[model samples]
Target: MLSNTDIAELLARQAERESGILSRAFRRAARSAFLWPEEVANVIAQNRSLTELRAIGPFIERQIRHWIDKPPHSTHRAPTIRRDFVSLAKARQLLARKPAWAKILRGDLQMHTRWSDGSGTIAEMADAATDRSYEYIAITDHSKGLKIAGGIDEQALKKQGNEIGKLNAFLRKSGRNLLVLRSVEMNLNRRGEGDMSPESLLALDLVLGSFHSSLRIVEDQTNRYLAALRNPHIQILGHPRGRIYNFRIGLSADWPRVFAEATSLNKAMEVDCYPDRQDLNIDLLKIAREHGTHISLGTDAHHPWQLEFIELGLAAALKAKLPADRIVNFMPIGELKSWVREVRGRAPRRP
Candidate 1:
């Protein structure tokens, strides 16, 4: 029977062979397949409308229905760019086998808000986190360096901190079990240097440094990874590989060395759970697990509902057999705060 992964591969191939609107339609469906919550075959077996799935329209639905009715053989493996991604449906299945693993998550470490490109307000994001019963969540909007994403500057970061302080106070007042941590996804230059001032970053509860430029280079980025890990201000490397499915393959690096460096510094590497950017995919995660490196799970969510994407990271970690103690998200709120503070304490102070 054709699974969503098989269907996605077929759609990607069709998109490659065709052109214009039809091609784009297939490409969109291929990407959307990752987020589809159920197998297309199973949906058909239950007589559900294919349109219920994202990016599926009547034309594409008819084609998918045909494939479902007559399962195809010899479906080729997904190419390098689209490889190794776990569909949401599959992640859900993997997580179900060990329900306790998901329950251990204390909070989401990476999310955006109106301070940057995210559509939701601080209060709106809080409401959603409250619903999930998250003990804490980091507001990691982009730094000023990444103008493309409406990144916030130091002044704006200060203002955002005020808003977060107010929100945390309100939550405490209302007896809500949520804490919105002040954080930023600080952009790093090629030298593993951050765009934000070190003094400004000091105020943040956590810092996630990421590369937003020069990502297409096929060279070994081992030194770059080392520098980022050694960066005193950065406690977590966000979306370490910078891979985006079907778009960029991301930078190449010596896996063991990079993970080892992160381990030595007591820094974490994030499994960005946004469907398209599941960087530090299972293959790399296996190496990270081998090195005893810390793991952080972030939905990289732009909106409230997108928080559910964290399950993808959870399943990936479980599959990688990462020790629960090594996952920062699994820590209690106080322990999590203590870890961040310790990471900061270890940093060499700027003159």
Candidate 2:
């Protein structure tokens, strides 16, 4: 249904987003006029949109030589999730042998920034992510409630959105493969309820409901979790049972009920890939896969560099021997969006 020019513009945007050097060169050259010769390279990169990014073969890389008139302060750091089976020291070698693993790490990621508690601003994080060849990044700083994290209030939310818009525009300038989505790492407070009011939650492009405190409450935890799941805005239940590996206590999750709730409600169970703090263990993942509950892996990254935790997720999945079809989060953005829609205002996807 899209016209050819529309396709070109979209590809141009994609090309510009994926390649910073080319974007800068094209933009500068365009500044001299309306378009530039570099736009051709942008089209090839757009090749991926048609093929779901698989079309952007490695052979098409265009070498662009440019010097930054104003060099960026720092580069985006790519987070690498060590396969639970391998030590950080040896992850690269194992990763090298498995090309499939690389793709998992390279998938879309959501991360935090100093806008909340991250080490940098949204732009810095976005740039760093693009540097690692990531396709997209979500700026999910903390929402109000966790003041220590500098959670955003109503007025601040507007400002944060503005700031993110600029970062997205910057990504546009770079002609790099990057997308910026406005999101929040909502806290599940003492009552096991999300901090944001419904109005605030809907404003976000993406929302993740997480539990940071009151995790020790064994009695009300399940009821509390259900409260969050019933909310349409609370898409993925961040680390379903807040477990900290073998150290601290974890939420006592009722799997049959939880997975059943997730499937029927179209709610996703998160397999947070943070080390020493992996919630939703391998066993639960197996249950989730078998029950056909859509699973989304998240970094729950506090810092920008931790976005690459998908490797940890992949390792867990591979250990569980999960197939690619069950991962709803990694589905194409359009399909993922549709799935989200189907879940909203509908009965559970399963009983």
Q: What C-alpha lDDT do the candidate models reach, one value each?
A: 0.93, 0.60
Q: Best candidate per TM-score, number?
A: 1
Q: Give the TM-score of candidate 2.
A: 0.68
lDDT of 2 by residue, 183-271 (tens): 78787775556777766666766677787777776663666777778766677777777765323557775677778877778777877
Candidate 1's residue-wise lDDT over 11-30, tens digit each?
A: 99889999999999999999
Off by more than 4 A, model 2: 1-98, 104-109, 190-192, 345-351
Point out the worst 10-residue segment of candidate 2 by lDDT. 78-87
lDDT of 1: 0.93
TM-score of every model? 0.99, 0.68
On the 0 to 100 scale, the lDDT of residue 86 in model 2 is 23
Candidate 1 at residue 245, lDDT?
Answer: 88
